[model samples]
Every structure is written in structure tokens, then in C-alpha cells.
Target: MELFEMCPVCQRVCDVQTRRMGTFLSVEQLCPHCQFSRLWNSQPIVRSTPAGNLQLSTSVYVNGESFFKLEKVLKAINLQLFEYDTFLRHAKMFIEPAIVSNFKTSQEMMLRRLSEEDKIIPGGDLWADSPGHSERSGSHTTMDLKINNVVDIPLFKSDEVGGSCQMEKEGLERGLALLQEHGCLDDLMALIFDENFVDPAPFKEEILKVTITEDLCAQDERPVKEEVIESFVTQVKTEAF
Candidate 1:
């Protein structure tokens, strides 16, 4: 038993007992006078990439303050903090529908039989003129079925959690006000999802040019900088959600 152990959940002092659950320790505390409950368990957050080929390491922030690093990464990608909030909400909606549609499409395509016309021609085979063969006909007909095993797409991978749009707008306004107060909005563009702001685009036409290497840039790697994290934590300190 421990005395004056602050419960992380309710932030109350209590006489708590610790018990082992498998390899981990769990804490249970009772506050008889206040109907207060506090339980602490350690769990890690996990995320799978769109291709289902990679498992990304994710960090969980219990409070809104913890998401600052994620916010910074979004900002580096030309996504505004406010927009990132909106995107997260929309992503939650997109997940269910997107996964279902993709699965159905794959099922329909996979269950279909291969067509004769799609068959591959042997390298050494020569074509012969016949009733069914034309001048451009091949020596043999084979049915080639091409199966697309990859189901993850960009839109599906970019999904986010959903929140009320009205609340989001207010949050954004507040965030903007805070940024203005701190005089960081100009540099803030780098934190947003604007390619033109973060990276240099020679011209408008250059922006349209697509290269295989550029596609990989979609993945965010920026860690939420400490200053921004502290600022966000301070901003919402008094607000209750």
C-alpha cells in the first residue's frame, strides 16, 4: 500500500494498492467520501499503414496537449493545425466506407475468371494465318489474370479521427489567435500542408510535375517541437472539455 499516491485519472490523493497483472503493474484506488475512481494501466498505441505492409509506431497523448507533435508533423506537410483537426475527423468517416468499398471491389474482381484475350504470348512462338487469326494474331491464346493484391490507397491511408466541425472551427480560431499573439503565423505556414510554403517550387508549372520520389514525401516525420508543445499545453490549461 502507498499513501498520498496521486491518481492520474482523477488527480486526487488516495490510499492505493498495487497488484501485478501478468508482467505489468495495475493500480487501484478508492475514495470513499468522493465517489472517485482511479485506475492506471499501461498500453501502447498501434497504427497500420495504408498498404497493410508497414506497422507505424504511434504515440498516444492522453490530453489534447499531447497531440502537438503530431500537429507539427501535419504542419510541416503544409497542413494547418486547424485543417489537421478537420482532416482527422473526416478521416474517421472515410475509414469505414473506404474499407468496405475496397473489399467489395476486390472480391468482385478476384472472383472473376480470366479472359482468353488477356493471356500472355510465348516468346518463341510464331503466329500463323488461320480463320480465327489475323495478320497481327499470336500463335497461341492464353488467359492472363492479373490480380491486384494491394488494397491500400492514399485516401485510405490519410484517414483521421472525427470531431464536430463547429467545435473545430472555434479551436482553430483560438489557435490562430494564440499564434497571432505570439507573432508566429508567418512562419506557421511551414507547419501547414502547403507545399509552396514548406518547399520551394520554381514555378506554378513545376508544382504540377510528379515524380516517384515525391510521392514518398507524403509520410510525416516531424516531431512536435518542444516550444509548440509547451505553448499548446499552456493555452488549454484553463479550458474544460
Candidate 2:
């Protein structure tokens, strides 16, 4: 504000017009004394997008931070910032699409590796948005137990599947479909499930249930569900050879 008070060319006090968008600032000075005019930008523009605007969107999405939370902080300090609609537009138009594209590229590489295997014993689990039956959404993750790499993750909303309890089954179905779509289902030898998983009746022949006893938990020192699945995989591999 102080720097813009006096025009540099004319060396006289002048009125400056300022525009702010998120972290980007633009200042235009038009001095009446010498008719000097100048426009300044705080940051560079990338394509049609302001660099600061894109950066803010990228940082918020990648760090798992919500725009509303940041908005509250900015409001408290009376700082100039973009609106929620603009953030949402940036996320939908840029952030989420790029994330999905990158994920697909990585997922295809993993699927190729899994396809080359003679047998794939993938571990599957469902994570609810909350630790309860009435959670709004859930995601099922399928990991290749042999290499300990994630193969697929399918997210489901409760409303889409009737209820939160139904999310697990829906997610598992979607995960299996993903594997099938990628031609990796043929090599699937067995599917391991966590303690919470039940009703393997749909795919009982390929299901291997492993429980993480207290001793097993103490020995593995990993997440209880993952340790149980990996222990099952280890035992299967040992017996096969």
C-alpha cells in the first residue's frame, strides 16, 4: 500500500487501483501529474490461469485441506481471497481430473505386474468414512499381497448402495470388477478379507479368512487387519513351495 502511494516515474502521490484474487495481486497506477501509467502483477500468469490461484488449489487438494477451513482463517485476518465457487471450479476443472489421470497411469502399471504373476492372492478391506454402521461412505482397497502394492480402490456412497452397511459389499464388487476389467482376475487365486468382512458366500471358494490373534498382532506390530491378511499370504506361499 505504501509503495504504491507515490508514482515512481512522476515522484508524486497518486491513486492506484488494486485487484486481488486468492494470492495474486494486480496494481495499476495512473499519475495525473505526468500522465505516467504502469501496471504490476504480484505473480506470473500460466496460460489463462493465475499462477497463485492454481498453486493454492493444488496445495489445498494435495494436502487434503478443505477450502472452508482456509476460508475461515482468511476471513479472520480480513485478507482478500477467492470465493468458494472459484475453489470448487479449480478443483473440478484441474485438480481432481489430473489426480484421476495420474492414478490411472499408475494403476495400469500395477495391473501389468499383477497380470504377469502365476497366481495373485489379493487382500481386500473396506474403510468406512467413520467407525460405525451409519457412515455415509466407504472405500474398498485391494492390494497384491505378493508385492504388498495396492491394486485397486473403489469408493461408494451409502445412498448409492441403499445404506452404509451395504457400502462394503458394493465396494468389494466394484474392486473385483476393476480387476476383471484389467484382465487380472484370471490370475486371482484367493481373496483375503479382514476380521470385519463376512458373508463370503458370493465367492466362498476363493476366500481365505485369517484372524489376527493377540500373539500375531504383537509379533507383526502393523495395522491389525493388514497384518492378518499378509500373515495369511505368507502361510499360503510357504505351503505352496
Candidate 3:
């Protein structure tokens, strides 16, 4: 619904709309005064005012950057009753499921599109442990040599991927398991990995088709084969095969 009123943030009359789907509520209000746009990702709660008018208000927990704005507003207004840190953490609990659901949907769609293409190759990456992390994280993504469109598969911290040093093989094995779990066919033209990367023995036939690119420098001290693939995959992400 569109509303004609002064914006609370910029104090200008503008058109505002509120939409709700399932438990998710979105409020978009643009300020003509400062040309600033405000979006609120919240969950709705219905209550009756003293005047008997039904009013909708979001709880302290909300998603994304707008939630921080709400905190700023509260501080500006000298409201100290709310627990900012607790609510901040709770908001993530509310938002992570939706993020996961959306990611799965996108992955399925990408896989479907890739299945239709005959020339696309499947490759993976074995990243060394990242900073501020205790374990190494290795993962794989789909690469389309035809259009060079790389569809990245989001890897969560909890995802079964292992460290590149010791867990490289385990990481690749987990990646293949996920592919089979998704019902992906063995239509991949080639599997690419680092030269000394451990073999995924479970899928030996599938692993036999693995391709290793020569390192430009010494070829021996070269980075893992999947390193190049991972870099390119990170550079370009598109659904088009």
C-alpha cells in the first residue's frame, strides 16, 4: 500500500509501501526531502491501540542493515530499555533460514540450467585455511568454459568442506557427495584440481577425468589446479551457461 506522508527519517512527504509475505514484512519509504530510501525487513505484530485502531509494529528483531538504523534511532531518542546485542543476535537467527532457502533455490536453478548444456565443465577449489578460522575450507563450484559463466556454490562455515592442507581430499569428496545428492548427472566434461591434490577415491572413474593445468613458474611448486579454477569462478558469476 502506498502512503502520502512526511518521511520519519528525512521529514519529507513521500510515497511509502508495506508488503508482507509469510512471516516476512518489507517496508519501503522514499524521502523526497533528502532523496533517501528506507527499507525495513521485519516481522509483523498486530495490536490494538487505545483508540481501537489495529496497528502493526515490528519486534526488536529484524534483518539486515535497517535493524542497525533502528538502533541508531532508539539511541537518538534516548530509549535504553532494549537489549541491543541480544536482539542483534536474535535477528540473525530469524534471517539465516530465509538466506539458506534462497541459496538452495538458486543452486537448484543453476544446476538445472547447467544440465541442459553439453560443453560445460565441472571444477572445484581447495582453498587454504582462511584467516580468523581454525580449520581449512575447501569447496567446489561449476565452471562453464563456453560462456565462462561461473556459478558459485555458497559454502557455509558448517558445510562439510575440509582444510586444503589435510582435508583437500575430504573436501573434494564432500563436494562430489553433494553433487550426487542433488541428482546431478556425470555429464561433466572434466574435473579440475591441483596437481598434488589428493584423489577422491570414492568416485575413481569420475576422478580419472580430472584435469591438472601446468603452473607457469616451476609447474611443481604451482598452486593447486583448482586454484586457477576457483579464482576464475570467483571473478565471474552468471546463470547463463
Residue by residue across 1-241, what tens digits does model 3's lDDT show? 4343666676668778876533345678787677877776653343311111111012433222454676677678865323455444444544456556877787778767766654444456655446444554534554444556545543433244433343545545555555545545453224433433556686897777899776677655757889999878877774335
Pull out the clashing pairs in model 2: none
The residue-by-residue lDDT of candidate 1 on 24-124, one tens digit each, is 34577776556576676433312312211111111222122344576577568864333345335434555446657877686345324221223311111
Estimate the TM-score of every prediction. Answer: 0.18, 0.62, 0.38
TM-score of 1: 0.18
What candidate 3 gets wrong by more than 4 Å, as runs, is: 1-82, 85-89, 126-164, 180-241
Ten residues in sequence with the least summed lDDT for candidate 1: 51-60
The candidate, 1 or 2, that scores higher on lDDT is 2
lDDT of 3: 0.53
Ranking by lDDT: 2, 3, 1
Model 3, residue 104: what's the lDDT? Answer: 74
